[model samples]
Target: MTAICIKCGAKKSFPYNKCGECAFDPQLAREDLVKSVCLSSGRYGSQFEKEKYDDELNSYSAQLRSGLSVEYDQEEIERLDMQLTEVEELDDKPIFKYLLRVFLPGILLLLFLIGVLVVLKWR
Candidate 1:
């Protein structure tokens, strides 16, 4: 059966072949688009690049909410919102802050283990 692809609005054999326009499978159109956009917008970039990505994300979100194509999937919309929030939050944090948050715990744990090993060896 041919149906309109929710992501690209192309008429194709639904649930079988991918959309020729966006290369998205009809069964998972929304998911494919959302994942593609989120993956393309990685966490690290220049300030100007991040701002550009933020604008793109906002545009996609608005398009989804605008109901231009098919009925919007609430779950997908929420996922996009969460991703947007995460991207914005990461953009605000400094590189040092991010590095510390990611690696400080491991460093502290290694120090504690070394201290324990030293005490054991002396004993």
Candidate 2:
């Protein structure tokens, strides 16, 4: 039986609501998006690139919300959103930034004081 693919609005012999391009493959697309956004650690080389990525993500989210494509599953979209949030949170933190800023100086000061005390004891 021939039917229309709800995603691309194309007629096909397949019984599924989605065409081959939209055939329950949102996971792959989501993975690509996550990789692009997360792997960069929020360090977009330029403002334009960052805006482009953000626009792409927002468009995908909108498409999922609008149900324009049969492959646009709501549950998957929610999961992707959660993952993006996690990535953003991770990007907000720099490695050892807090430790360096808050503790390194204090530790150095303590070591210096201890060295001075040992020198005085040797006198």
Candidate 3:
């Protein structure tokens, strides 16, 4: 009987066996999950990048949780949950900070141009 591999969604001979498509083994799911979590938790260039990482982590957690016959370590899943929470917290920066960072340079340039115009007008 063929069953779907939870990690890669590929058809395998059995639910508990190693996946041929992605080489995902139920026996090593915990290690893979930890590795994925560690990889996802890193410095991101922008909010979009962080959000993408968050999505990847979420999908990985879901896949592990939905496995047909695989048993994941509860403590490991809890740790992943904590890491996901941290990632989410990092993603939720105040909009005011982002806006200021993006527009400060333009605002400064506009002020400098206006100052130059005012001085020229006086002359």
Candidate 4:
């Protein structure tokens, strides 16, 4: 079996991550995969890149089971946790239509009063 090298498109032997021609260590290789994350919008990145990133991570095979620390920020993770906790209430709109209805009458009344005053002054 053969696996394709992601950095340089070349067919290489499997099981052994290091290329015969280019010695690319899997640990160091992961840093390159970080680029797949499109942090611009802080949302999901290119699906194709994300797929490739997952594939490359899986390519290590054994590494997944043992666990690896990609060194994700603890603060950022906590912030995301807080965000997830708040996510449930995100859908619930706080605006009450009654407030607008009440406000509209007051505004209309003020405008009518001003309009009456303006006409009286004009006369």
- Give the number of the best model, judged by lDDT: 3
Q: Candidate 2 lDDT, tens digit per residue, 31-62?
A: 54443233221434576776665554445445
Stronger candidate by TM-score (1 vs 2) = 2
Displacement of residue 90 (Cα, Å) in model 4 is 0.9
Ranking by lDDT: 3, 1, 2, 4
Judged by whole-model lDDT over C-alpha atoms, candidate 3 comes out at: 0.59
Q: What range of 10 consecutive residues in model 1 has the weakest lDDT sum?
A: 35-44
Steric collisions counted per model: 0, 0, 0, 0
- What is the C-alpha lDDT profile of model 4 across 1-123, one tens digit per residue? 334333433344442255454555433533332221211112224766555544544444334234432334456455544554476356443455657776989999999999999999999
Candidate 4 segments whose C-alpha is farther than 4 A from its true place: 1-45, 56-61, 67-71, 94-123
The CA-based lDDT of model 2 is what? 0.51
Q: Which of candidates 1 and 4 reaches a greater TM-score? A: 4
For 49-68, candidate 1 gives per-residue lDDT tens digits of 66665555555545544565
- Which lDDT value does model 3 have at 76? 56
lDDT (CA) per prediction: 0.56, 0.51, 0.59, 0.45
C-alpha TM-score for every candidate:
0.26, 0.28, 0.28, 0.28
Off by over 4 Å in 1: 1-68, 95-123
Q: What C-alpha lDDT, on a 0 to 100 scale, does residue 114 get in candidate 3?
A: 100
lDDT of 3 by residue, 1-123 (tens): 324455655554444567677787765655554433343424344777766766654555456556633455567557765775676577766676799999999999999999999999999
Worst 10 residues of 2 by lDDT: 34-43
TM-score of 4: 0.28
